[model samples]
Target: MKNWMKIAIGLWIAAVLAVGISMPIGYIPGLGAKARIIYFHVPMSWLAVLAFFMSMWYGIMYLRKKDMKHDIKSASAAELGFAFSILATLTGSIWARFSWGSFWNWDPRETSIFVLLLIYGAYFSLRSALEVEERRATLSAVYSIVAFVTVPFFVFIMPRMMTGLHPGEGSPAPILNANGKMYMEASMRYVFYASLIGFTFLYIWLFNLRSRIGLLSYNNHTEID
Candidate 1:
């Protein structure tokens, strides 16, 4: 990473930690003390979507060029996405336990995330089942591209279409509204947004790190061969 990027990431991390630890905000009407989880949970969910989208983009590139590098990129992004998706689900469930009175409610949002997990799980299984490098890369890239078609539906559409405990169904979103208005107080909103920005940069940094590691491993394996 560039020095500038490193500096920015450091500053972003400080901001997120500062807000997460010290931001003073009143209890939300519905969520109470559990509302603080919003800062972390929302970022995880958003990053999961972003990661999957990146995987799909790389998958498309792999299909076009048949490059193992692109395949590596797609798989790395998917792996990160799968991790974030699990964290999001866990954090959301924790919040749900306090707010909705259950850890697993089988709500539309929960169900959608479960479906997403299964889809990504299958992607990895497909990769593990294939032995030939070229065949694995090609097939996994295709699977990655096709599986991404469900991302939008599971993450955004289905939850809103049916009644659920999560926001976006004409319910009050934790922070910003559809028109970009903050429902929380100004101070809280500022901290919340700071966390969002910080987490986004954090995701970028992590993705870069993982991609570099994948590249290095690939290069080392080829040398050994």
Candidate 2:
């Protein structure tokens, strides 16, 4: 990201924090004051998915181009995806304590995310177990693609397929419904979307920095070899 873009992201995030905290959310039966978690939790989850997708994208690019830079970018994206997914888990667990009376009730959403985390966790372990740069990158790239295939099923499909405490069918789904329509109050909607956008930009900046670091490390390793 450019200097101006970084400054803009900072401003946008500050605004999101201001509005998300100050804006009075409308009534949500189980959530009440705790509903504010959605602003942070949902967006983090969204970022996890987006980052993982980018990982897959870069992985495919690596396979086609046979470039170590693309491999570095792919690994960077996976690292961010795993980190964001952890944040989402924390936020969701906190929300669950309030809404579901426990930190983890093993709800479908919780189970799915946990499984997703494990899947990606294994991805990192896979990367570390391999020593050869070309072999590691090739296998990691293929694993990234395969692992992401489960992402949609784990993050989107599986939870909804089974009963879950999340805002979805047969429950008082707030903000967004099972059909993917937003029902948030106008003010809340604006702030929520703005927050998501800001989170995305933040992810982009983080990805750029992480990719640069990965590239440097990879280059140094190549030189040493």
Candidate 3:
């Protein structure tokens, strides 16, 4: 198999096996049905944060080096970050519908994620609107760096201050216990961690592919000029 195909297949197999194992473990007497969402939702949210931080890191590099490759990397990471954030929001919304009796309630947590979605969407729009390549990169990089300032606030601060329907805030004891440790059954933890690793690898693979494609397209267009 081609290298990319091999990587893709490996990721698929890992995802499938993880989900299969997670389902049975999630059905264990103590764990319950809601545990299933952990496999998807938690990983999506985690990966989204990871991707955005990566974008910011590359953004800094772009500014320092003024290299288009760094810009491409930053842009690719933001695109993937946006995708993961959307998935996280949808999964959270669905989980809420079943667990909280509504799809959305403008809860601080939900509202913050929605804001993140809008910010990233606007980033893409900003990219599309500009005609000059260097200008587009610089502007978007600045926007990304500024936009991520809200991430820490939204993901960490706002949730803690308000007594929302979400799990983390206003509880003496967190949903996950002290030490931030969770008590997933062995099987579920295995699969859940596997899913996390697989998803991360998939993100890296996709980001590299996207950056390469962008570079190739840029080169082709320049050749035409």
On TM-score, the candidate that comes out on top is: 2
Clashing pairs in 3: none
Tell me how many residue pairs clash in candidate 1: 0
lDDT of 2 by residue, 1-225 (tens): 689999999999998988888888888665677777777888998888788889889999999999999999988998999999999999899878878789998887788778768878988999999988889999999998887787677666776667777754466456434667676678777888899999998998999999999888878877998
- TM accuracy, model 1: 0.88
Give the per-residue lDDT digits (tens) of candidate 1, residues 163-185: 77765346656543345555777
Tens digits of per-residue lDDT for model 3, 83-140: 9999999999988888788999888778877887898889899999998989988888
RMSD of each: 2.4, 1.7, 3.1
Q: Which RMSD does model 1 reach against the true structure?
A: 2.4
Structure candidate 2, residue pairs in collision: none
Off by over 4 Å in 3: 1-23, 26-31, 168-179, 183-186
Error of 3 at 9 (Å): 5.6
TM-score rank order: 2, 1, 3
User: C-alpha displacement of 66 in model 1, angstroms?
Assistant: 1.4
Q: What Cα-based lDDT does every candidate model obtain?
A: 0.81, 0.84, 0.78
